[model samples]
Target: MDRRTLWSNGAVAHISLQDEVTAERFTDGEVRRVTYPPLASLCKSPMGNRDREILWGQSFNVLETDKGWAFGYALRDGYAGYIEAQMLAPVEAQATHRITVRQTMALSVPDLKATKAEHVALSLGSEVCVTDTDDKWATVMGAPHTLYIPASHLTPLNDKEADPVAVAERLLGTPYVWGGNSAFGIDCSGLVQIACHACGIACPGDSDQQMAQLGETLDPGTPLQRGDLLFWKGHVGWVSDPDTLLHANAHSMSVVHEPLQAAIQRIAAQGDPVLRYARLTRL
Candidate 1:
């Protein structure tokens, strides 16, 4: 069981794992939705290293709560980690739309020009339940109140982008955060996951999981093309073309497009060579 997806904490575990894992306590967890956005970090330990992020309105299965932290897995990708308890709330409504823009504000009123309106920033991939809509704005349910956001920033939950690469291209310059998944910042695997999700593909949260579970491996000398996945020991990227690689890289501290051959050489020099080339069945 990968610890990142496993619901156990040595002493307790989700009831679903009872047949395979030992624990002192097993219980069915409660589901809750993230109330804060731009992004909320899910840390390996309470306030420790971030392992992933749960976007606003995304559901989390809460297995345990201690002090002010909730330990659970993100319902979207099953990545388990600790999140600040206050950042989540009881699910009041199912999500009806997904935020399509990089970022947008949920305002106190429908009018964008309202100077004193209270607002909260929402990020791309965040889900919202729109109760009402006009030509320019949507009224969505907030944690404790109703909020309005631009209608143009949202898409129906069932809609998907046709090309995953195009979804990633829109985030070309986002900062490379170690475990970030939002447009504000993202890692290599996070970028791939986000892009895949937009195209209605199921993806694992970590690079290793994605490499092992996402797609079929290609032959050693397979010709690269758009949307092909390239994996290194601890990193991953998308093939933008036969000659270009697109990824959120620590070396650059941002997502970028680089010559594929040059990237291969650069990464190899650091003792991590390209490990595999994969092509997804759906794309």
Candidate 2:
């Protein structure tokens, strides 16, 4: 089993894995929601390297808790990791809206001009429960009090962007962060996941998993097109056009649009040539 998705930690595992794996204990995990915003790092081990990130209002199934860390898998992508236990809370309400922009401020009051208004930056894909709404602001139940966000920045949970590439383009210039999943910082796979999720397409969290599970592979020599996925050994990028590639790359340390041929040549020179060319079934 893939350790990233498996709910086992030698001592215990989720009850769902009882039939397939051996463990000293198994129990049905409790569900929780991420209460922190901007983004929450999901670490590979307690205080270890971040394997991925979870946005506000996203669900995490907690199978174990140790010290101050919660060990579980994210419901959005089944990526398992450790998260700060205090950053999560019981699911009090279902998310009604998802942030549509790259980032937006959630103010302490409904008016944007309030001088002392406290604010929190919410990133794209963060979800919230809209309890009240006026023409300009939306009231959401925040940790300590109700917060107001711009009505124009949110969309109903069921709504989705029409173009994944267009969604990806909005995050151009985000700093490259290992295992990051927000507009503030992101990795290549994170960029693809955020864009695909915005378009209502389910996607895996890592590049290899994304390569194995997403889109059908194109035959060798297939011409690249808009929305096509190009995979290198450990990296991936979206083809914005026949000649342009969009990705969050370590070489640039940010998400950027660059000449596709130039990227291919540059990456190949580093010994990681293009591994796969794929086209999504839906777009």
Candidate 3:
């Protein structure tokens, strides 16, 4: 699992391949399969940083072809466009992997010498690719030594064993940053977005996006449940139970759990009374 920053930007996002040789194209929607691994590199174009300037994630599906390799990818968050033959890699997806946070976690390598390297530096909301966990440390790719993080610090965003509440608590004081998905920075929407993802639900990335995904809109007076999804205009949070909701607020840098009534009052005081109401989505 060699990690490459999606762009030269400081933001480090993690993506894994489905098979040994898949193309990671410049444009998102291209699909191609290769017999070898891609050169561990970032997606760069001959044009001067044009594509790199934008913030987006592309989903590409691998397709095997008679030619040496080919790729088909959907760019711009799976909605608008597709491209082909951008880049290729030689490895496949692993059934197991650990995400990392610490600057240097140790990992055992194919070379047999234990190596210590910078694990992916996702603040809080960012994710990493871990191959396995050895005792107290997580074994990530490209490093020779196993990296250590509080077992409590990592979540199985893709695992059935993950504890959503425990994971959500790690960011108690994290500041609310728009479009932030890492602990170093996070947004109200990203807080609930990732929490829901950890629990095996596919939530849209923002408040308005999330509102559309809920099966139905409930009146604010309705009872809530633990793990219920709640939304406010331009903001969103998670319900820990009928009475408590958790969210990252501009007013509160870290995620906070408060009585639902208090939270609604707080929002109403801000002059955005519509932000006081939440539509609930039960998972």
Candidate 4:
């Protein structure tokens, strides 16, 4: 079959099997084939964070049938497991374009003549996919990343455009909440994890998980820029520029951009020096 990209970032579908099959699932692992990419935080079960998570790079081989794709998937870190076909989504890749602004600006519905009517509150340099552009808002198919602008602020990259830097900015001002992954709330590590996910990159859920996955660390004095994943022992965040970090800090209660020096000092006061033993994940 010809290869294609699936746009359903977090959508799910079911498969019907003609014969019973084995499920060799693993957690923190990946699928064997690239037939389709699973959405971030996608769960096979509707239960609370307990469903079989089809992490990035993971796949399940099924018997080709006249009806549709059918088979079980190996989930839970490639551990011993098997789930029904009724829990997955049938997806294929579609073309997408990523856009970055020439200057610091906000995203809004293109239809609105003024900012107040259409402002979507996106951060400057934020990365967004343009599925279709009208006069104002750009329609991003998969996860609703439609950003509105004056049609003059954006510079559209081709389909398959991936900008991790602009992706980091979209999470600004998200509140600091434990286990919260959506824009409504997020933690330092959660911020980095989700940003990577949006950019079609795989990252673990916690700081330690992320640290273990990505090898080595970068020198802080080297200057962290946009899309650089910043780590500090138990916490992680993304850098929007050389001097500012985007993250959800306890003090702020939401995602915010802070000077590197100030963030270091603040975390250090908590006995967790932000720079003392920090790591960097470059995607």
Scored by lDDT, the top model is 2
Which run of 10 residues does model 3 get worst, by summed lDDT?
A: 49-58
Instruction: Please give the CA lDDT of all the candidate structures.
Output: 0.91, 0.92, 0.45, 0.46
1 against 3, candidate with superior TM-score: 1
User: For residues 1-283, what per-residue lDDT tens digits would candidate 1 score against the true structure?
Assistant: 6789889887779998999899888989899999975568899988899999989998999998999999888988888889999999998889999988878899988877889989988878899999999899999999778999999999998999988888898888999999889888999999999989988999999899999998889999989879999999989999999999999999999999999999999999999999899998898
Among the numbered candidates, top TM-score falls to: 2
Model 3: per-residue Cα lDDT over 1-283, one tens digit each: 2112121111111133323333442222223222111111112222212111111111234322223323222221221111223444323443133232312222233222335533333343333345655555554433223434434445553554245555576677776665555465567766765555555556555577667674466665667666566666777777777888778887766667888768878887877554333443334
Ranking by TM-score: 2, 1, 3, 4
How high is the lDDT of residue 12 in model 4? 21
Error of 4 at 127 (Å): 16
Instruction: State in Å the error of residue 277, model 4.
Output: 7.1
Better of 3 and 4 by lDDT: 4
Candidate 1 overall Cα lDDT vs. reference? 0.91
The sequence of per-residue lDDT tens digits that candidate 2 reaches over residues 1-283 is 7889888887778898888999888988899999886678998889998889999888999988889999888999889889999999998889999998999999998877898989999988899999999999999989868999999999999988888999999899999999989988999999999999999899999999999989989999888789999998889999999999999999999999999999999999999899999999888
Worst 10 residues of 2 by lDDT: 3-12
On residues 1-283, what C-alpha lDDT tens digit does candidate 4 reach at each position? Answer: 1001111112221222112222232122222331222212332232224222333223443222112333233331221223233333333433233233322233444455464643343322233434566765555433223444444545543322266556656666656776544454567766666456555565555676666664346665665556666667778766677788777778889888889778878887888865333334444
lDDT at position 15, candidate 2: 91
TM-score of each: 0.97, 0.98, 0.56, 0.48
| Pairs in steric clash, model 1 | none
